[model samples]
Target: MATSVKSLSNKESKLIMAHMYVAFTALFVGATCGLLQTLERSGKFTLPAGIGYYQILTVHGVVLGLVLTTFFILGFMLAAQSKTTGGLNKTERTVAWIGFWLMLVGTLAAATMILLNEATVLFTFYAPLQAHVVFYLGLALVIVGTWFEGFVMFKRHARFRKENPGERTPLLSYMAVITMLMWQIASIGVAVTVLFQMVPWALGWVETIDVLLSRTLFWYFGHPLVYFWLLPAYMMWYAIMPKIIGGKIFSDSLARFTFILLLLFSIPVGFHHQLTEPGIDPFWKFIQVILTMVVVIPSMMTAFSMFATFEARGRELGAKGLFGWLKKMPWKDARFLAPFIGMLFFIPGGAGGIINASNQMNQVVHNTIWVTGHFHLTVASAVMLTFFGITYWLVPSITGRTFTKTMNKLGILQTILWTVGMLIMSTAMHWQGLLGGPRRSAYSEYVGNADTAAWGSYQIAQAVGGSILFLGMIVMIIIFVNLAFFAPKGKEEFPIAVVSNKAALPPKVFENWKLWIGVTLALILFAYTIPLIDIIQSAPPGAKGFKFW
Candidate 1:
């Protein structure tokens, strides 16, 4: 019983619009900082010493990586839940609005500190670099807000199950719940680090902090944070892409299975991010690396399923040849092209992920520009592109408008610009990384040094790519503005792909969220317990915080 576009209540529409507004505004601010960083690194532009490169970097990462992704995903999920599951009840809606405002206020507070140069610690906010107490407090509030929203979603889904005991949860709603569940579990590591470690240290309640312990906890939350960005994009791929392309989901059961596996495996693999770090046991790191490798299985399954669906649709559309089906796709549709281009970038991005997760390979590229390249490809290109694609129709749907022809054409161009920019920037970054270019540093110092001269050219390329990306972002914002405010009023359909009739529903076990949650916790404990204990036991004397900026 999907809710029609016209059926949306004013409250739901306003809430959804608020979420999107914050998300897009963050995107604009973050992308501007990103462009400045790229140019600054290339020695093409320089900021005053009062506003250091690291400060801008911190703002960029927080706004884009943490704030934008968090707000957008929650908003998107709320929209999906409303459309598919009869909208949130009054209590849930009230709570959701509260959460949104808390997150927004916290974001503003944090951004103020960053802009004031009081909090130069990067998004990881790794220890030894202490920020203003307000920064940590703001981040804590954001996380708490998200938790409140996650609770509402979980309760809503529980009520749905109670009402329809034997039926499987709707695919979109099911994925949304799994995503939030994994986030709640995965966020615990960072939450503990912030609430107990960083907050005390920042407030001067503690003289020094345990650097290793803090980092260990951060990565514990950090790696799964990738999945938090990714699963939402995957939801669109699995549940909505098929409909846009005139096909049903390949298998609803398999989609649910993939999400379940993600919940189980995503958290335990956090240690893979620590492969090159000391203090943690190499053996435990090895175990986590294997676990990280195992998580790839579900992504591979998704790839196969999506390709099969695309192929079937292509054949039905009368396309011939092995690769001709790609041509048969709705190439002119910005919604499809944006995400499809993102998928193309992910082919390399995912491969880079495998490389980064490898014990041997990670040593070569740890903390290098290659790691940046990989994440940009996945999170920036893949995840953000999909988010942009969703905005194409999502804005119009909530506003009771349709995209202008000019806006749709601009959307397509924006995607192309983004794709091209990412390829250029990421390729340059990868090559420069292999040549020993360090990440998270102002590299302009080496511009003319003969020893590091090779990196200069790539830096220039990166700047060019970044400029193009900024352009694309501006265009995207323009398109959204037009659709949201000025476009002619018309009906815009919500596209929720159907499950193929031939595909049988999974066993009831697949829908047993309680069972899967328990197994997921067990796996996380098995993977993290020993290493975390060892780190706590062997931690060196605490570090007195520094404010380098």
Candidate 2:
């Protein structure tokens, strides 16, 4: 009954599938790297001397964190756009394809350099650990491609607004546009760093790079990068999950407000990541810490809204009692179950985030495995699981195929494996971190060092967990391949939740993009401009690039 009223055109279907294909391929490569890294850290496995730990780590982070997430989000947004609004017009579709090709070429270029060991610089790409010129160039192209896609989406939204003057923009399209807009703004910092700073330095045009300045620029993009991955998951949680469970969004207005808050607060809090670094005033760090805490409010609001929606749906199903409502949900459906489990992980993930944001508390966990555990919960568990859940139905919707009932069962098992694996690995990471186990180290270096021996058991646990996670990923990839290419052809449902009765129509002001964007820019300027100026003026002499590995 929740099936899309209109089917996607052949062109739209092809565009969506193309993006998804790249994303899944990257996921496979990234997950394999992840398992390898975990085993290496546990001392159970070792790469040949030329293939170093940092090299594999860099590949894992870039492929999964950057390439996979970016490609998947673009594809998912396009699919959402087609289902919610009419599919993109011919010109828009052509633009999207161009962007996809650019991204693909860029990804391959970057991956090649990293694989060749020319760019051992980690995903953070912090200088004086410089990457090859092509690595920077390739990454720049990917960002430009995303910008093109963002522009097209913005244009489509504008046309929609012109056509439907007084109506609230369709929720999915509105959210998608906002996500892209926020990313465009957020990425400017990284873009500047790469184009003007890293590229020239890598090409020998500049002999040295200001390490602190480069790191500052990267963090400016890095913190919001989490939200870039997150907001889409939020989109599914707020707009799609409720419908999958036969309910409505608790409040459309609140959802929009939450996104607005994220856009405003997300950029200014990058300093929270750099609290331990010098060249920035403690005052500015304190300011960013407060801003980071402020950003958590919107997540809390999301939690309340999600629970309220679930409760309302339960009541409608004639369920009574507090716990009984949970049972009424469609847990059998992978589309609902996986994302809901993701939401559950977000509770802990968000808590860890708040802890990391605290200026005082951060010192204890800074650069430790604790931070790794925190992010794995957020991005790997919360955001990634939600993406997997989306594909359970989305791939079928685009391909006009049915994900077989057996495949659905396997999907559930895959989610369980991932959840259990992440819990085991992340828990060990956090505990070992608190005990002073450093992150980003080759465990072989600690062999026979009594100081680090306590970490061995935890590392072993991580390896076991990583192995299970790898299997889970393999299962997911197989399920999707079957759904896309081998499954029986049939129409699949595309769920879009309705606004709840308790929620009134959002005010026109909520749709005032100019106001929100202006406020976001103002907040960023207020928070970052002065600190950046201070950093520039007081920066130490730049350092020459190094390739220690």
Clashing pairs in 2: none
Q: Superposing every Cα of model 1 onto the true structure, what RMSD results?
A: 3.3
Cα lDDT tens digits, model 1, 432-467, are 777677888886555323356666789999999999
TM-score of 2: 0.96
lDDT, candidate 2, equals 0.87
lDDT over C-alpha atoms for residue 153 of model 2: 87
lDDT score at residue 408, model 1, on the 0-100 scale: 84
Per-residue lDDT for 1-549 in model 2, tens only?
333322577788889899999999999999999998999988877776667999999999999999999999999998887677777888999899889988998999999999999998988988789899999999998998998888878888888889888878888898888899889998998888898888888888768776777788889899999999999999999999998998999999999889888888888889999988977889988888898899889999999999989999999999899877898999888888899999999999999999899988888889888998998999999999999999998888778888779989999999999999999999988987776678776653443233565567788999999999999999999998998888777787877888988898887887788999999899888888888778777765554222211
Clashes of each: 0, 0
Clashes of 1: 0
lDDT of each: 0.87, 0.87
